[model samples]
Target: MGASQTQLRETLDRLGLTVPLADALWVLDPAQPAPSMKTLAGQLHCDPSSATFLVTRLELQGLTERVPDPADRRSKTVELTDKGALVRGELIEAMVAQSPLAALGPEDQAAALQLLRRALAQAERP
Candidate 1:
């Protein structure tokens, strides 16, 4: 979904969250399986200290928890708790509702997604 910075900020405020924390939640997406906390830090472009802070906040809210990485016992992965999933859903719904993309039907949204994917692919090219 599309949204302006102001909208995002407002939404986060309504959810009692900050911008970085919201971004962390989005990156901690359940679709890709559990990505390591290091990966999460990289995705957020934050230092280890910042990542620790974000994780602490998430844990305090019972939204996400650190689990032992399946591939590496020494590492941990961030997994969304059931409560986190529901909250994430609410955030997405709020964003979508505030976005112009909400007016588009499924077919139109799919076409938009296709275009965005193409744009992203092109942007990634050297």
Candidate 2:
């Protein structure tokens, strides 16, 4: 897992992204309501201040933007820009290319995915 993370970081660095920012962008759904800062913090398992800093960096890079939350006029939500989505796609491709699963056959990959999903689901349970 550490080696995989290191490879992902190297790929992201080549594209001018940090792991946190890439993670934040990857979680966003273009067709869904953008998550509020607090929600993002919860998703990232970080404090609100850290989420704010990450968002600020993404905003400066023109990869993300903050808009007024319709549900709460005083609050804001973060969404990916067109550029961010493109970059995120590239990141996905790069990560997949570097993945150990890349060497597996399609059937093996499917099996692996199923097992991994099962493990994740079990981990999520109490």
Residue 25 in model 1: shift from native, Å?
0.9
TM-score of candidate 2 versus the correct structure, residues matched by position: 0.91
- lDDT minimum window of 10 residues, candidate 1: 1-10
Which segments of candidate 2 are over 4 A away from where they belong?
Answer: none
Error of 2 at 23 (Å): 1.5
Best candidate per lDDT, number? 2
Candidate 1 lDDT:
0.84
- Writing each residue's lDDT as its tens digit, candidate 2 over 40-126 gives 999999999999999999989888999999999899999899988888789889878988899999999999999999999999999
The candidate scoring highest on TM-score is 2
Alpha-carbon shift of residue 113 in model 1 (angstroms): 2.8
| Model 2 Cα shift for residue 14 (angstroms) | 2.1
Estimate TM-scores for all models: 0.83, 0.91
